[model samples]
Target chain A: MKLYEYLAKEEFRKFGIPVPPGRVAASPEDAAAAAREVGRPVAIKSQVLAGGRGKAGGIRFADTPEAAEAEARALLGTELHGHAIDRLLVEEKLRIDRELYLGVTVDGAARTPLVITSVRGGVNIEEVPEKELVKRHVDPTWGLQPYACRQVVRRLGLGGPVGRQVADILGRLYQVFRSRDAELAEINPLVVSGDRVIAADARLNVDDEAAYRHKDLPRVEEGTELERRVREIGLSYVELDGDIAVMANGAGITMATLDIIQAYGGRPANFLDAGGGASVEPMAQAVEVLVSTRPKAILINIFGGITRCDDVANALVQVRQRVGIPMPLVVRLVGTNEAQGVEILRREGITAYRSMDEAAARVVELAKGAA
Target chain B: MAILVDEKTRVVVQGITGHQGAFHARQMLDYGTRVVAGVTPGKGGEEVHGVPVYETVEEAVEKHGANASAIFVPAPFARDAAFEAIDAGLRVVVIITEHIPVHDAMQVMAFGRSRGATIVGPNTFGVISPGKSKLGIMPNPIYRPGPVGIVARSGTLSYEIAANLSGAGLGQSTVVGMGGDRVVGLGFVDVLKQLERDEETRAVVLVGEIGGTAEEEAAEFIKGMTKPVVAYLAGKSAPPGKRMGHAGAIIERGRGTFESKVKALTAGGARVAGFPWEVPDLVREALGQAAG
Candidate 1:
């Protein structure tokens, strides 16, 4: 889960990391008030989960409170990269002698936490030359030792007092990264002043699976209202840009379903997992959620192991009776209780295929016909 | 002749009193797996499906002589449960729990490796040796004893492929679900290595997805093996950066792609199947060539 800049900075402050003081503003009036509180030139950064906000004109610098208010007024309620700018971070602007990048993240391949620092900063790290970036893997058992920080600092060609300060910041950042169960904790541009280094921006991606440990973190509001509503019903739903709504039981099967759909020349409208071991109620809710997308057709694929195909079939029949599906529905049910599942679907005047290939082809044809 | 667990391998269940643990425990026992003991912290004096339960894995190992453990502990406590089993001197630990934190998985994996223990998964269906012994959540009726060894990441996909293979007169020696998480303990390489050494497994089927370099790494290892391998990789048409349910099933920064995986495996002399259903024919053809 990605946190807003203000929230991430708040976490950074709690860890004793130096960050430009900031307040979150939800409206133009609040933006002016926050700018007045800071009593200096401020940067009004639009708060949205998506990236490239600056290039999209979601960020602006204001020399005065009125300017800040105007900038906020222009961005508020506007959509950037399909995400609304509902809030803004008003932070004190600082004079920077140089911009340096530093962060800590889990290297998925190595299965180790990595500390990354670079002399080239204030730009996308991917665009920077590989030679300019200094990276070191921190052993999960031993953690980020002081020597590890010094190595990153010295490689970037920093020395004396400023290098020590940056090294200290790097150490503390690693602490926050580990303790918070963060997938990524980065300060894109750690501005270097005369003798001080401060974080100009914070980008934190917390591990959603580790959310149980931290109750203090705010809940991430994702996707559209319909998508959110479906999530509230306890189904994992992701909206996509297509015309066929695809639903499956397991993660691997769901992806395979999506792949086969696209392979047969059909686009998927959404990715919905009924979850492993889901019964009639959750399965019914899943169908209801899939209908909310209003796709031209629906593909319900279940390779039941612990999850029973009969349960899924029963739920589909229930939804067909109560809600009355308007779109063409294609289903493939296999594994445990599959015979009963197929019989139930057939009795309901719905065609259920035992082969995923047949179901996928039928759905794609239906989708194209509907289109 | 199976790679890991067989009829002689005494199995212990960790978190045996839990819903999933108890359910799968009964399934394993019914399938003729020698489930000698179960471990649940405070349910020491209890029994799950007539198998004796112990507080610690050490006690289970000491009292029952169990060499393999199938872990059904919840995600939060899965690491500790695995650690206990490893520290207790179990050689093979099969973890069926999902959503274990990556850091915890890393620690347990490192600890397991150091002790020469093979940790299967942090999010898997466990391992199954058809008709002889089963140590996973797979539906038992779908399997039969044959010369093919299967190693896969996705649980349901593997089941689908296994059933298809069974229908085509090809059964499995053992099928291992390597889990679908980003950071899993054992990879395709480790399991493939085991299958290569097993005399019962004449040919191998690798079910992979577009994630991590596990498939690529397996391809590198396959170059050294004499056994024929047939591969089927999922998520061919999946969009980049969109996680297709599995955490590891995504294409990012130009790596872990379906094309790359297929290229690597094909270059390593494995016949890569276009779809899961095609695997059976590929396996048959690969085996026939060897016999010829």
Candidate 2:
């Protein structure tokens, strides 16, 4: 769950980290009002969950209230990097003496939280030379200490009051990261202006699995309608641009099904995991959701473990009877109760393939024939 | 002879009174695993599948002499369950719960490490030595005792490959699911090192998907191994920036790409299978090469 710039800044402010005066605007009129409130030249940033927004024309500057409204109007409903822009963060532009980067994210390889800071900021951290960056692993038990932050600051060749302020900000940002269950909390271009250091841009991505703990965070609607619908049904779904809709029992096998489809010269329209141990109703709902996409073909692959193949087959039969699938459907059943599942599907005028490779080939041919 | 669990290993099922825990406990018992006791916090003095349930891991360890724990606790309490087992001095703790908070997982992993214990997963199918003892949720019929050692990040994919290998007359000594979370205990390298030293494992098959540097790190370790390794990677057609089912299966910062993992593994002298079904043939060929 990626927070909008304004929301991240709000969190930053709560942690006592300085952020430029900003207001969230949902319309051109709101943008004009926000510009007037700011009382200076402002930056109108599209509140989309995407990086490199500045380079993608998702950020625009306005010198007047009318100009701010015009800039907001241009970006309000536009899609940047496939995310719909429904709101804008209108903030006063600041004078920058320098830009620095500060972030804390999980180090997957290390299995711990890592604090990253760099002298080079306002650019992609990946593009910056590795030598310029300073990184420290923070033990989750002990957390980020002030001494460690001071060391990172000194390593970046900063000293005096500004360095101390930067160190303090690092500690505060870490608190926000830990408290929010954020997978990533970053302030790119931590602007240094005269005597003060302020966060010019904020990015906060909360861990989706940790969402149960943070119910107060605003829910951002993401993905296609079908994607959202499947999510409601407790299935993981991702929309892709292809003709064949692929459904499988687990994440690994679902991804493998997509790969096998592409390997067999077919493109997958979506990736849907029915999940482990899915019973008949959610399985039926999953098929209904996939069929609603109306792809050139539908391929259902199940390597049932705790998920019985008979349950999957029953869902297929149920969906076929109720919804009446329009697309060419291919079914592959394996593992626990596979024989019973194949028998069930066979009785429904469907021949289930035992081999995934053969099933993938058949689905690709079916999709191509339909095309 | 296996890497993790075998006939000598005594097992305790955590969250034993729950649906998954009870069901898999019966399955493990049926597979000839020494499931001596269960722990359900408040459900002590009860019997699940003829196995006695205790209130805590300490009682289970003390009464049954259980050395290993299979956790089926809910995600919210998985950390406490792991901590309990680790504190009880259990040598092996396999957490079968999914959707556990990353912070909880990190803490449990650190605590497990400090206690000199091996924590398999916070979201895994558990470990199995096939025909010896099984501690996971994998179906019993697909596996058998043999020379190949399998380790994977994905459970279903590992089952698919193991079934195919068994069909091709290449049975496994053990199959380890390293879990699909971004932060998990017992990564590819840890399991690989164990398999490399196991006498029963003549060859190893690595089932990897896009995400993290675990596979890359395993590739570095694979360079020094004497036993043959076959690698099969999934998510070849997955789009960037979108997580593919697993929380860990996303490409970020131009890293953890399928191409990169394949390159690293190939350069480390491991045979990379083009598809999951192709894994058996590659394993056979590698085994043949090692024999010749």
TM-scores of all predicted structures: 0.96, 0.98
Mark the regions of model 2 whose C-alpha exceeds 4 Å error after superposition.
none
| Cα lDDT for residue B163, candidate 2 | 95
lDDT of 2 by residue, B1-292 (tens): 9988999999999998999999999999999999999999889999999999999999988888999999999998898999999999999999999999888888888888888999998789999999899988989999978999999999999999999999999999999999999999999999999999999999999999998889999999999999999999999999998988899999988999999999999999999998899999999999999999
**Candidate 1's residue-wise lDDT over A1-371, tens digit each?**
88888889999999999998769999999999999999999999998887788898989999999999999999999999998789999999888899999989877667778888998889888788888989998878878999989988998999999899999999999988988889899998999987889999898888877888878999877667867776777776767898999889877778778888998999988878776788899889878878866999999999888999899999999998888899999999888898999999999988788899999999999999998
A1-371 in candidate 2: lDDT tens per residue?
A: 88888999999999999999979999999999999999999999998878889999999999999999999999988899998899999999989999999999999889999999999999999999989999999889889999999999999999998999999999999999999999999999999999999999999988888898989888766676888899999999999999999889888889999999998889999999998998999989988988888999999999999999999999988898898998899999988898999999889889999999999999999999998
Which pairs of residues collide in candidate 2?
none
Q: Give candidate 1 regions above 4 Å deviation.
A: none
**Candidate 2: lDDT over CA atoms?**
0.93
Distance from true position, residue B8, model 1, in Å? 2.2
